[model samples]
Target: MIATPVSSPAYLEYGLDTLFGRITKRAECRIGLEQVENDAFCFAIRVPSPLSDDLEQAKTLVLRVEGRRLQGTVRHSERLEDDSLRLEVEPD
Candidate 1:
């Protein structure tokens, strides 16, 4: 999948793997592609923490952008002031 910058709200599906071995649900989140690279991109999404536990680094994760299928590992995750989660994805 091509990594391109999107100005408007780009819809992406985040499939995060849980540590508790619960069912992985496709949680829809609005994200902005901060920077796009050859095979990776930086994004910030205000995802609710309750949706999933802290995504482990290098953990396999699923991303769907405009129906464009892409897989990546969790490079980083930060908790926002609003108790939301922010993620940096490393696409594979």
Candidate 2:
């Protein structure tokens, strides 16, 4: 079966790496949800350069979907041709 994107708005909360340390930050973005197996899901988001840079250094993240917060690790990320970033997250 094909999975569809969630209709509700999604927000990404992650730590931004800085010279001193990491700072918490959040961004509103759209995400696509796919079920890899029973009770397992994958989240995908596309973000701009600035946010992408932060995500590259992020080890874990919090995703708010429909008011429910899910914590996950940054499983994979890639830079698109337009300089935006695409990320895939697997929730613990």
Candidate 3:
């Protein structure tokens, strides 16, 4: 598959099941280009610091962009000097 950069606004959502129903944390983010190397693929996105802890803990999240939903796992994350969190995701 050819990976392309997503220019639309993306949202990340992770949910938890509770007695009250499934509560979800959602944050707006920017979806980077999907990269492929040596037959392996990787995806990435950037979210604000406010959601960093949640995303890191959740590990897996649904990325919604341009009407498409991609389920991915966080492979790695790093905090930028500007405080945004850059996450490396492997789409499943």
Candidate 4:
């Protein structure tokens, strides 16, 4: 995917992959990309933390996982205290 300065909310779909060579179907996720660093970008995502931990037949543990099918809206953008950019993204 081409990463650039996002002017509008972008919607995308991403595949979920595990470390054990397992792949799950694509899921819907929303994201708002905001210009933060000179070369890096801060993506505000709306995927909440998992509320349950049941590793059984189809349960999974997520850690630093990437998502797709993202849809978001840019509310505002500003500089952070750490000299980084902070973009307020609300899920649409």
Candidate 5:
């Protein structure tokens, strides 16, 4: 499902990218959140850039969903046909 991320004055809630305890935000990007099998979370980053371990794709991510924060690890990420990045995350 397509979703607009919840807007917040805090960059961490919107533009901030948390990785290795560091927060970074460059160009703004949107992602669709979905639930996968085994309580995993599918976070889709719709960008043309390829997914890499440098962008924290290989590490755990904290996702804010339904007013709660969930910890997840990106199991795999692939460049979609539409140039988007699909990350299969398993909640931990």
Candidate 6:
């Protein structure tokens, strides 16, 4: 789906910590126009960091917007919560 900005420059980006001790910087990962129903949205973010041979494995992370923030997990590897629909993505 990969939602994109329409009227303005508003979108969501996710940063991941990879298994190579490298931090994945923030980048726009819009699921699609149809996916974003309101100011609030939930998306499955994959933290590339692993439990083995990786930096910290990125067990817990944060999701922030305009000041409001929430905590996310990589316990099962990038599984988005049920509050919002999951966006279709290419196979990793």
**Residue 60 displacement in candidate 2 (angstroms):** 1.9
For residues 1-92, write the lDDT of model 4, one tens digit per residue.
23333233333332233677644333323222433334233244232222112111122212122433433444444444543333444444
All models: lDDT? 0.50, 0.65, 0.65, 0.33, 0.46, 0.34
Per-residue alpha-carbon lDDT of candidate 1 for residues 1-92, written as tens digits (9 for 90 to 100): 33344322334434544577643444455443444334335443335544444342325556655655556656777777866666666766
Better model by lDDT, 2 or 6?
A: 2
Encode model 5's per-residue lDDT on 2-90: one tens digit a residue: 44343311111222235456453333333455545454345443333443334434444555544545455667767667655655666
For every candidate, C-alpha RMSD to the true structure in Å: 5.2, 4.1, 4.2, 12.3, 6.5, 11.0
Model 5 misplaced stretches (Cα beyond 4 Å): 1-28, 37-53
lDDT of 6 by residue, 1-92 (tens): 35333222223333356568636433332222323233244333332212123213444444443333444443333233533223322221
**Could you estimate the TM-score for every candidate?**
0.49, 0.59, 0.61, 0.27, 0.48, 0.27
lDDT pick, better of 4 and 6: 6
How does model 4 fare in lDDT? 0.33
Cα lDDT tens digits, model 2, 3-84, are 4454446788886667888688777866544554444477655565544446666767887776567777777777889676
Total backbone collisions for each predicted model: 0, 0, 0, 7, 0, 7
Model 2: pairs clashing at backbone N, Cα or C within 3 Å: none
Q: Write the number of the candidate with greater TM-score, choosing between 4 and 5.
A: 5
Instruction: Name the top TM-score candidate.
Output: 3
lDDT value, residue 28 of candidate 1: 54
TM-score, cand. 2: 0.59
lDDT of 1 at 67: 54
Candidate 5 root-mean-square deviation in Å: 6.5
Which portions of model 3 miss their true places by more than 4 Å?
Answer: 1-7, 15-24, 29-40, 49-53
